[model samples]
Target chain A: MTSPWAVIIVVIYFCILGLVVGKWGKGKEKGLNEFAVAGRSGPWWLIMFTVLATWIIGSTYTATMGYAVMSGAIGIYMAMYSVMGLIIFYYIGPRIWVWGKVHNLYNLPDYIGRRYGDRRLAILVAIAGFIIGAPWQIMALKTFGYTTTALTYGALPEVAGMAIFAIAITAYCVYGGMRSVVVTDFFQGIICVVVVIGGIIACIYAKFGGIGPMFQQVLAQRPEMLVIEDTKYWTSIIVASFLGAYCWLEIFNRIFLAKSVRDLKIIARGAPILVGTVYFLVGILGIGGSILASVNVDLAAAESGLLTIFSEVGGPVLLAFAAIIIIAAEMSSIDSQIATAGVVLARNAVNEFKRTKLTEDRVVKLSRWIIGIWMVMVYFLSIGELPALIVIAIVTYEFLATMFPTIIIGALWKRGTAKACWASMAVGWIVCGILQISPVTQAWFGGWGAGITGAFFAIIVYFAVSLASPKDEKVEALFAEVEAYKEAR
Target chain B: MGNKLSRKSKTRLGFAIYFVVVIVPILALPTLNRLNTAEPFVGPFPRIIFLMLLDYLLVCAGLFALYEIESRRGDLL
Candidate 1:
């Protein structure tokens, strides 16, 4: 019943508490600063790694490989949309930071509200952020149960295991807020990197003699797993990815935390490499897993595909390590979702309803409650059959991608009128939603292709509407202030 | 006069290198695997090397792009 290695890793994992505890005195207990952005104490390198590790969750590890196993190499080709998205993150991240600090905006909705001077638009944006973000959190819960259960080889029932992990994530998030989450993230991130690289190496050595032999076997057996077929798929992937990357709430939240434009630039620069390193490693696992799965390997368990492979190939000890690694991976994103949801809701939704307004403590409390509510809703939604992992990822990201042009260009363009923001967002959302329901998404734009349609319509509507409408003085002033802030920094 | 490049020029040059040097190498690495000279090393290693190189190039290009975006928000439509 007891895996000694699992117990030890759990202890070491808790030992990473030192980072959070040490950061405690550094104003972590203070207002919104401590709860949301770690009081802006972290440097660019650490923040970059934290973001990368969180996004690369159990779903990323397990599902991507599952797809690779099922669809050949194009599964990774499908997942590469995320890589392109992160690469695009490197470009726009700094601008958000510059404007974030200048305007003193704490959440995505806060930025929108400031830009348009419209609380209603801000609320609409917040709802979109929350809706898009919730599926990813739900997926994490499913991954948690599936992965931990897989690691234990069905020692724990999937539902019970997922519930326990979800409970622990909620407890810590409630107590520590973003402060606790970031500290835990740093710990989980290191485990993720070490285990992924180690797993990939071990897998390659086990399956084939080495990397060379593995590819030869793959090339001999499955060639579709080795090459990209369509150039349009790649183009669509990159453009759609750029849209997703620019609009992600977590990335935007980090931009707000940045101390200066210079710091933002450094973080943006570091992110792609950090993300790409892990992405490349995961791609290797996909390649290796494709060959292994060809031998009728079942990737039925959701979260810890690597663990199933390790359990079979390596031993119980490595299985335990993979379990801990998957847990760490799941925690990284779960906590971020909780923290980001709390920040946006408190600032955009609940606070607006208050007379005297909510305190930071009250806001933190509300965020915790939101996390609980979100988990329960997600838990119920995931009870039956699961959606395709890549499909869920694309749908949610495509939904959020509608916000990209408004948020990114709205910050820089003084000529972008309020009418433009409203019209663009309305059109984009309606169009994207219609497309998703229409046969267009299924027939022509299946897989990574549907993403392009949503992103394309969003950007086009945003630009054209803004050009057609007249400018708002209030919006112009915000842009002017942003310019001054960038110069001053 | 020694030709002194402006920051804008440096950024443009960086973008150019990104497309030319970084992307070209990655795009070519797959072609190299077609040679089929060796087994494991031949097929995968070159692709991996190019990807790793592309990762570094992307990091640099992203930074250059971020800097350019921030400094030139006025110029952006």
Candidate 2:
């Protein structure tokens, strides 16, 4: 059972966080642009931390450790998607930032719509972004729920845990919007890095003296865990994960908030080191968990390995620290997703469909309501037992991965027409859906992995259709404008 | 401090890092796995772990160098 002191500490932590939210987020409410994109004026430091915090959600803690425990060295491959995605972003992010600034864009669909000159495609992609994006929030909430329940030894039920987290995240986001989210994210990001690194260090000291001994223990006792047994799954996951990196709208949305294109480039350079250090530490913790399990640590669930290790090695204090880190990671991600989803729904879906000019204040209000609705939906979905966090996350990535050709090719290649964009998206989704749900197809092509297969087909179809379709004079003109804009920069 | 190099040159450099740091490591994993036998420990870590850590460090260093060079060239935006 959780100590009463720990509970009090957590309650105090929440109150403090709430106050921070109120201080920075309150009275900052403004038009939809300020609410959604922080007036597109975030500095490199803020952007760096917020982006890192947003990406390194609860799954980064739980799933990385889980994969490491399950697959040994191959578990480090878990960071493949993020690392690759960030690197790719180094190139693409500046362009997107510049485009968003040049066009007064607010979301991915906004960019797509303006780029393709198709409002309907924008709406479709917005809906698709929500569909693909919502699951990640749900998964993060579920992770929060499960992790909290585990921390409290079931004194707090999963539903109650989910509700607490959902309410806390929703309140802050509703109050402050993107400014609040980014501010809180900067704070939360610091907590995560400190606590996670601290917890791992404590675990090493308490359990096996140091890194060298812990690794030696694992090698001696559980050598098989050190081997990369499944080569096909390993390779497929790396490829699919690299592609999956681009699919996240929340990450893409950060491009819009960048103060300048230079800020994006700076972030791109520094993000890998930030992400690498944290994930690498988590990977080491996973190795520690594997060693602990070898000695019969009685981990209740594989997903809870990191927490369980903390409890066993560091006692209540360290466990409480671990709890805070997990909560910080979850909340940072949840708030960002909630805020981004609201923007996508309101600006792209509702506002675009209405074709009515709403006041900035009204649009902000609508976004808050949509955020509330999204929170409730995610809360309900999170209550049920779902697939493993990584599996669900990857599946979501596969769905979003369909947008790659449109996002990447459409930006660089002017031949991409609206019809081609829609066709590629539709065909990719259908193929991925078939591969995901059908047992026969999964078994037949499971080796290739559904994500990679779908992406392959999506890319092929995108190029074929774009080549066949006649080039639009408007698109040609837009590309020329984009080139001139680049030259001006 | 990032004005010396053109955006195209910076992008090309980014792609080059992507190929060397991201793509090459992933492609070489299969071949690396072949050597994942019971090798002696390099310092505290196993051979594979040491090699992976080396790869990660190389990526970190490469990215840092890219940023430093670009930043030195003058402001990009």
Tell me, by lDDT, which candidate is best. Answer: 2
- Compose the digit string of candidate 1's lDDT tens values, residues B1-77: 99997565466466656544544432343543352122234335534333533555564565566456645653221
lDDT of 2: 0.77
Q: Which 10-residue span in candidate 2 chain A carries the lowest summed lDDT?
A: A293-302
| TM (chain A) per model | 0.88, 0.92
Worst 10 residues of 1 chain A by lDDT: A72-81
Candidate lDDT values, in order: 0.64, 0.77
Instruction: Assess each model's interface with DockQ, reporting 2 decimals per model.
Output: 0.19, 0.42
lDDT (tens digit, per residue) of candidate 2 on A96-134: 677787778888888898889998998888887787777
Complex DockQ, candidate 2: 0.42
Residue lDDT tens for model 1, A199-274: 7688778868787677777777776566544434544555566666657666567666555556556655565555
